[model samples]
Target: MSQAPAVLRGQVVDAETHQPIPNAQVGVADNRLGTSTNDDGRFVLAIPPAYQQARLEVALLGYRKHSQALPPLPGPELRIELRISPAALGEVQVTASVVGIVREAVARIPRNYPVRPTQLTGFYRESDNEPDGRPRYLVEGLLTVFKPGYQQRGDDGEIRIQQSRKVDLRPAGQLVRIDWAGGPFITQYGDFVHRRAQFIDLKHLRDYDYRLAPGSSYAGRPVFVVVFGPRAGNRRADFAGQMYIDQDTYAFLGAEWHYTAAGLGRSPNRADSRSLRVAYQPYAGRWHLKTVWWQTRARLPIGPPLNYFGEFLTTAIDTAQAARPDYVERAQYHDVFLRNAVAYDSAFWQGTTTLLPPESLRKALLDQQRQQRADSLFRPTTPSAAAGTAPGPAEPTQQPDNPLGRFFSRFRYGASVGAWPLAVARAELAVAYAPAGYRFGAQTTALITDQALTGWSRVEYQYELTRELTVTLATQYVFRQFSGRGWAAGLSYQHNLRPRHRPLYGRVGLAYTCQTVGRQLGTFTNPDDGLRVAGTNLGADRLSLRLQTQADALQPTLGLGLELSHKFELVADASYLLPLRTRTQLEIAEESGFFLTRSSATVDLPAADVSLRVNGQPGSTLPWRQQHWLLSVGLLYRLR
Candidate 1:
């Protein structure tokens, strides 16, 4: 048959420096046949049995280029030299998946590998030759998100728009602030999304372990090849593809990630094997993504897209009282300050950023209830309906895990729409009930601890006008599974909070039903309408005041709330909602006076962009609660 080839020889060099790149990429491509270069950047591979003409490739990250072809018979003591180069030039080659270059040149991997490979770094080592030519750089770009209606997790993963600030580098390797004032960025910051300054030089990765993977190469030079494995805290993460570094100067031609998070038009993922290819131009000293084609599969969390489901607060001001009445409103604050999307209001309590008191509110309300049971002294922190301080007196029947609000809670005004139909959108949950089934004179429906799960909810828009709670009109649209389409409208008054924490604050709304309750034909049908109008019965009008509060004691998890509702007809109101929990309620009216009623325990699947709540009817139509009760638990990740 065939005998193993004899003399084996190869040239080795630095993958970056390109000049006699050395000291790496020894033996065979895999665990097959391989050898490293000597001090002279050269290696001899005495072919083992059964191999043909082959050469060894010397490689390393942020170093000189690697030469693999072999010349005639180069005896042992092969010569090989490695040229060191700067890391983080205009381009950086890497992989989205936890990268691992297992050769002796590289080591291990970490956890939570990157989901997307949009991360880039730049290394600036004063090129003593010419300096001023690299001051102002330009990076034109385009980013497309997943289809508007992808089946997988979307809305929360929409394509994002950004214009990031360019960072400046000092050869001394010192921390330097960027020109923050001149970003003129196209993107805004928020709890849900935003961008960062582009400049984390790779120079640091040089003496580090891992080496490049086999079938991978760099798109640009000095920045040519990059080697990496899982970092410290990146296990259990998905691995993408390898990045190609340029064989010349350290610069970025672009990236080649295994998974692409962006898409074209509304097309779902066309391929499971994602790849992100980019086109960049070198500006002053920076490189930007000019054109990028990001591809990935559907049903995955991949984006920074047009997110439309966060929440905010609003207030109604009575300008008649203040000399300078500002109908001021706040939109997407998550872009600037995450977790601080509290809607703006017009009342005294508006504009103040406050942390949720997970414990105090509950204690205060419970203490009041004990006093009422003692038949002892009477306390009046606030008047019942006197209009002075809303938190008049401690409520005797304060609810634990309640959503209707403690004693007194008032809200400013401004959910109303101006130019756009959306005044404020958010993720929420809610529950409804009928006690005595009447709006005005009916008794509220809420029992001990009972709740139902509805997905994220929406709150309607309101505007500030007067000083008192009497604003001309308060309109709101709530997204629910109502008759016909899955939405309802509501209109109501401006409610306020007395500064109590238990179920912090809520809203009081009213809805004039236009049509009667109908059915939802979907396989997973939820409640379409609560009112199945009896024949000849005029459509019913609803009235409610719901309260929902966050429990700081359980930060980063768990949400709680309560609701109190009434229908004008008295016998048509019910209220009690707990997600993945039980709901017990009781209804009362001017006629029946009071009575225990419907009770239901169910699971609540969170919704997309609306706040869930139990509040006064909105739009004179069925509406969503202003405060969200749609609590949920899950993991969060970005697709950038």
Candidate 2:
């Protein structure tokens, strides 16, 4: 049996002014356990006994990260203070020496980054600005990124769409076309840490010449500024830019880069260029991408000049809980297409605050609604009519679908509402309405939240008994692409428990569930379009359970569950929230379960198969087992 874990408590503060730093990251260097400081810069982390000898790390943006061996035993009240980093890199601002510093920083990536899955919830915005600085098209979105351990690479990190909004204000009769692919994902693709290594990797360093210069201070920290570009004799289309690394941890802090005309895919004769700026901040002992700004311009031979500018800002980071490896099935971000996903009403917007003001957001949405309405009303019914009438605003030409288009289009919708989550490979829809605190709706289980729709068709009903209590019943049909499709139903009663502190609350509930698993559970390479299939889990299931929890915005939630069965399961999860500002709160949660008796099986995905090793033996099968184990970090937002 595993020994109980030890608890470490402390407060992270600024050294000079001695103020608490809210949302500062605190963790043990070698374990999956970690947590962030609350508003008071205080934190409590459950450290596994295995990492008793490891160091504890504390970090916040603009400040030097702090690390020290854990106390021999949980000690007295601890206060970890971080100094504001000096904004200079000593006298080593020389060229040859600067390259060495860059090399060292790159080498330290593995040691400084999180080895476990980490989730970050941030705000992202993209805009097309007119020459006068007015935004022609604006989009804002909340992002939940499941960062793979530092050992991963590329867009390997899973990105989930939380909530988003967009507004297009092109002149009624004119259209401004800018590629969405390059709008924001450029930042993801341009990740200086895990990817975009060509800028710093030793193997790729030969392509560019390096220079060193003094850089301005960032978040009050001094940095070593290094500039590099394609060698004079080597004129390949490439990026030329300056990069800054914190002098202390050797972490990449910020960069100013420009794409050459050739790099923009324009001919030498065409005047084209794009300037981009990217910045990072130290969070919880790791550097995170914080902001990206860029502007692109071109002189097209056939049409009016093209100009576009965009910016992406990250608002929060939740390091307390890591996200499930499959937090979001990556393909869904593409399959359903963000543009055609979900739509929310003004209530949603009113309930959430973003980097932009509520009034500004309202105007943007209103303008888009008006423009869409006008286009629909003015659109000619026939091609002949379109030609006969004076030309209306030039319709946006349909371009070949590209990954970038789908990514940006995602900013237009809300999280999926119906059939998208379950079927894992099929499209689904849902319809519902509620009146007087009661609701009736039909939705597919397959496509509910972030995963593929479960294809479990269901009709649901809910009745509010009071402000804090409600009762719900749902009957669902499970349809598998292969077999094992059946029916299941559940009824649950829950009561919300509130503490005097407004931001804190909890829930208690009771539920009964019944399910039937067909004899042949089919597995397909691609549920939507796979040609191969196999049978798997087979059984009938029933359960009765009771649950209780108490939590609030600023405190970690504590929950307990009891399953009423011969062999039952026990589950527990905890979370804490940190308010970054007026309407934004970052939440992180983790869950683990213990089952006296559980089902086990091995499933294969010919299309998405993964290899594994068991007890030091290489294995080709993924054993599906139920017992007690740690869950990935979950990030949630309380934005109003």
Top-TM-score structure, candidate number: 2
Model 1 residue runs over 4 Å out of place are 1-24, 27-221, 225-505, 511-640
| TM-score to native of every candidate shown | 0.24, 0.40
lDDT of 1 by residue, 273-384 (tens): 4333343444333333333333232222332221111111111111121121111221121222211123212231211222224253233222345324322222234454
- Off-target runs (Cα >4 Å) in candidate 2 are 1-93, 130-135, 171-179, 182-184, 266-271, 298-302, 324-340, 345-347, 354-640
- Model 2: per-residue Cα lDDT over 1-640, one tens digit each: 3587777778888898999977555667532345567778888877778888888876544456677998855666689998875633432223343455566677778776665667765655565555565655555556666666666764456565566555555644333243343243544655667674567877767677776555545668855567788877765636788888765566778888887645666434244777878777678777777776666776655455556655556656667657453422331322222242334333454355555565644443335664354345333255655679654332332324455433332221011112212112222222111112212111111221223323334443444444344454544344443112222122223232322211222434433433222212112121111111123221213111111011111222244322211112132323223322211111111111235342233222111222223233444322211111112111111110
Reference-based lDDT, residue 584, model 2 = 11
Give the TM-score (vs. native) of candidate 2. 0.40
